[model samples]
Target chain A: MNRFKSFVIKEFYHIFRDRRSLIVLFGIPIAQVLLFGFVITNDIRNAKIAVLDYSKDDISREITNKIVSSQYFSLAETLNNDKDIEGIFKKGRVKMVLVFENNFAHDLENTGKANIQIIADATDPNLANLLVSYLSAIIMNYTLDMNRLAVVPMQINMESRMFYNPELKSVYMFVPGVMAMILMLISAFMTSITITREKESGTMEILLVSPLRPSQIIIGKVVPYVLLSFSSAVMIILLGIFVFGMPVEGNFILLLAESLLFIILALSLGILISTIANSQQTAMLMSMVALMLPTILLSGFVFPIENMPFILQLLAHIMPPKYFIIIVKNIMLKGTGFSYVWKETLVLIFMTFFFIMLSIKKFKVRLE
Target chain B: MENQVVITSKNMIKKFGDFVANDHLNFEVYKGEIFGFLGANGAGKTTAMKILCGLLTPTSGEIFVGGFNVYTETEKIKRSIGYMSQKFSLYEDLTVFENIRFYSGIYGLSDADIKMKSNNLMDKLGLSAQRNSLISSLPLGWKQKLAFSIAIIHDPQIVFLDEPTGGVDPITRRQFWDLIYDAAHNGITVFVTTHYMDEAEYCDRISIMVDGRIEALDTPFNLMKTYNSENMDGVFLKLARA
Candidate 1:
């Protein structure tokens, strides 16, 4: 036990004595949280757009005022001629162009319908789609208000409610994702690099030749990283709560317990990686390519898994972070309890056990 | 001289998918003796040493280190022996004192014992002033010596050095031999593998391995007389050429 304690202390010395990794350890979580929170968001604010008002009527003017006042858009240029709309869009100063057809008010008054053409830059399809939807909603609201007194024969009222995130704040989605990503990065990447560093530096040979069992050595090497990753998880959670106004609606203790389970899963994956990698560079490359990319792309962190193709959806199911993100989202946002996340927790536990067993078998084979 | 053997191996064979690394090797190392294991690159010297150090399991062998079976009692063998690899095994980021303390502590040394031993070790190596310095900042020779010292910090019955002086200057290598001599004199068996031929002359009994087989095993004087060579290097050249 004393030997294990000393071994753990040695591992800590390796971590704390290296100033650069220390910065990466503490610096990355805060930077990622703040970056994903304030920057790198889907919430469109003040999108630049040009208005081509050909109608020159109070209704067109009022619609333009509505778009501008909604805070989702800011008018960059107002065009008179139809040719100017193309020029404004080509200059890239605006992301969208709202064209009000000539005699818009006259048509609405006589036929109860008017044409409003929305020309958006589809270079970014997602942002373009969002902008068009926002513009259409504002115009639809105007028409509804204008014809409020005229009773329709049959009308179906569709009231859509976004549970947990009523305003659809992007930070609510990102906080859980950032937590998954940061924990995966720190736990898997850092642990793999550290263990492979021993192999590269030949210290692993010395450790193996000592009285300590290989399992003891691995556990000792991993304990420090587990603690570090747990702290990083805490830092991300605290940042999410205080800085991004994210709420921990579920049991806080359960959330932390699940986070620790994910950390152990990542750590075991790291050990498995280090077992296959002979050098630190190889270990780092493997972790980044195998763990980080999948965690970011396929874990439902940045992309919705349901929207992906069948094959990619199948691939996303294999990623540990996908289920972890689900658990975190449910616990933090919906305030769900153990029953809601037990299946995910079990999968994480199984994965951790599988990786640990695989790594131990690989490590023993390597020694032989 | 009391020729009490501390290490014994009979027909030791290590195979990696039909490529035999230690092919039916047999040798014995006596207590308080410096046994030199000489080999060319890929000559299986490291393979044999690793098995003895409990780092590898031989496919078939009857091996003993410090009277403990290498198969069933590997942990005991590990505790009874110390090892230093060719790559200096000290953590380059750690201070000299810390490295010593860490190794000693892992070997189950008490806190007060570690303090006293590390202090004495630093003073003995004339590195008291640089005790707090990182291992990377030290010269290669100092690092090699310090690694050797840490390898034996627990005072094991046998210490294995895998080319301990690979990159050191000749003078430093000579000084390192003095430390080995001191350890041997204190009843610790030294099993060292090296490519340096002159180092073979310092061993009481040397075994030269060529392609997983012990091609020659004897004292330097007897080996010289048997090979009809003037120096250990000439003997090695003749055997290698043959």
Candidate 2:
């Protein structure tokens, strides 16, 4: 134990002595959380749109008023003719245009049907789709209100409720993902680089020949990183709660415990990487290519895994962070218990065991 | 000295697949003597040293280090020996005082012992003024000397130096040999490997390895007479040419 203590202190000295790495360690978590929370969001607020009202009627005017009154959109320009629709979108001032056909109210009154054309600039298809949906929702609500007063016999009323995230806040989605990515980056990438650094400097040989066991050496090297990654995880959670109003709906202790499990998993992966790489540069490259890219792209951090190709969906299932993100989201957003997340937690545990075993095998081979 | 064999190996062989790294090696190192193992690049000097240090297992041979079997008692062997590599292994980020303290602590030395011993070592090395300085700030010669001191900080029974004076100047190398003599005089066995034939002359006994085999082992004077050469380098050249 005394030897392990000294070894850990020496490892800490290496970390604290390097100022650039120190900055990157603490800076990345905060920056990622804040950037993902405030800047990159899917929630549309005050989206710019145009209205082309050919029907000079009270109903058309009321519908236009309703669309702009909601926080989802703001009227940017009024198009006088059909020719102005393309011009407004070409200027990039508006993402969508709502054109009501002439005699719209007359058609609704007599034939009970009216045509409203939604012309959207599909340059950014996601934003255009969202704007059209918001407009449709408002129009649907207006028609339902009209039907309620008119005593319509046949009406289909659809009620929807979004369970976990009621307001559809993007921060609720990004906070857990950012936590997974930051923890993986710090634990796997940093630890692999540190271990490979010792190998490069020839210190690892000295340590290996020392009285300390191989397990002790590995544990001592990674304990400091475990503490650091855990602290970063807590900081991200606190930022989500205070800044973005995201709730930790489940047991806080369970969430932290699961974060620790994932951190250990990532550290074991780092050990495996270090065993394969002979230099710090190789370890760094391997970690970025194998761990970071997969965590960012295939783990559903930015894009939905279900929307990927069939082969990519199969590939995503093998990523450890995919399960970790799900576990975190379940605990933080849905307030789910261990029962709800047992499979994901089990997968993480199995992966940790597998990586540790592989690392030990490779380390022994290296010694030989 | 007495016939106290500190290291004994009989027909020790280490093979990487079909290539024999240390083929049929046989030697015995007595206690309190400076024994040198000399070889050219890829002559299997490092492979033999690693086996002696308990870092690798011999393919099929009997080897003992510090009275512990190299195959079954590797952990015990590790605790009883000190090893320094050719690459000057020391934590450059750590201060001179901290490096000593760290190595001593891992060797199971107490805090009080480490404090006193480190002070004594720094004072002896004339590094007391730079005790707080990082190892990287010191000159190459000073760093090599400090690394040697730290390797033996535990007072192990045997110290293995694998080209400990590789990159330093001749003056520092001479001074390093002086340090080696001092340690040997204190009754610690020194096992060193080097390619510098001149340095081999300073050893009590030298073994020259060629093609994964020890071609010659004798005192410098005996080797000179047998090879009909004036110096250790000339003897090495003749053996390598043969």
Q: Best candidate per DockQ, number?
A: 2
Question: CA lDDT, every prediction?
Answer: 0.91, 0.93
Error of 2 at B198 (Å): 1.5
**Alpha-carbon error at A54 in model 1, in Å?**
3.9
Q: Where does candidate 2 stray beyond 4 Å?
A: none
The regions of model 1 sitting more than 4 angstroms off are A106-111
Per-residue error (Å), model 2, residue A170? 1.3
* Model 2 per-residue lDDT tens digits across residues B105-160: 89999999999999999999999999999998999999999999998889989999
- The C-alpha TM-scores of every prediction are 0.96, 0.98
Q: What's the DockQ for every one of the candidates? A: 0.83, 0.87
Candidate 2 on A78-185: residue-level lDDT in tens?
Answer: 888999887887889989899999999999988889989999999998888887887898899999988888877877898778899988899998998999899999
lDDT of 1: 0.91
lDDT of 1 by residue, A8-113 (tens): 9989999999887788789988998899999999998899999898898999999999999899999999988888877877889999999999899999888878
